[model samples]
Target: MFGMRKWNTPVLRPTAPFIIGGIAVFYLVAKAQDAMINSEEYKNDPRNPAIASGKKAH
Candidate 1:
């Protein structure tokens, strides 16, 4: 059958919706990582006193 022959191809095109969704997820994860790395709350935590004091010598 013609339909069966089409299915036998080794390469298949990705659908637009799935591609868009993957890009959105990747963007969101990158933004979250950036926010975490640059957050002031994370840098000034009392539990890590050394990090807070290290920035003051400059």
Candidate 2:
């Protein structure tokens, strides 16, 4: 049925791109954390002078 009606289809094109970009950003962050865990920096925990000298009351 060909009925002449003006219907506005809200633009949904940007939704997918936005979601994809967000996922990419979070993925990169996780990858960075993985790299850190593999690095020596993460493996070695630097001693804190303050905590070593005196224990602060919690």
Candidate 3:
């Protein structure tokens, strides 16, 4: 067993650029969700209960 090879796995590292990109991605996703919740089709969708009270789902 000692002569056999072992699994080689890469370490997880979060660099500065990756972190900044992640933050930007999160911001864009949040903005996209906001736009979706404010869309007319979403507001009129039967599955959305908040629209019945004239309020967006947020």
Candidate 4:
């Protein structure tokens, strides 16, 4: 003898979009970081100058 409930359905089966969206976001972030590390733009950025001397501006 088995007892089954008629109202025992899952309420979260519509989360496929959110799960796929999260994976896509993570992939984009990783790709961007890889590009930055391998690109010339990161090496030529002036905000992070290699010179240790501070310049005085008028």
Clashes of each: 0, 0, 0, 0
Q: Point out where model 1 deviates above 4 Å.
A: 1-14, 44-58
For 1-58, candidate 2 gives per-residue lDDT tens digits of 4676588655667588988899999999999875665465544444533335564422
After the best TM-score superposition of candidate 4, give how far the Cα of residue 21 lies from its true spot, in angstroms.
0.2
**lDDT for each residue of candidate 1 in 1-58, tens digit (9 for 90 to 100):** 4445645654336476777889999999999875664577665555544455565321
- Pairs in clash, predicted candidate 1: none
Which pairs clash (backbone N, Cα, C closer than 3 Å) in model 2?
Answer: none
lDDT of 4 by residue, 1-58 (tens): 3588777766556887888899999999999875664467654454533322343211
Better model by TM-score: candidate 3 vs candidate 4: 3
lDDT-superior candidate, 1 or 3: 3
In model 2, what is the error at residue 52, expressed in angstroms?
20
Give a tens-digit lDDT track for model 3, residues 29-50.
9998868867878866776656
**Judged by lDDT relative to the true structure, which candidate is superior, 1 or 4?**
1
Task: State residue 8's C-alpha deviation in candidate 1, in Å.
Answer: 11
Clashing pairs in 4: none
Q: Estimate each model's TM-score.
A: 0.48, 0.52, 0.55, 0.52
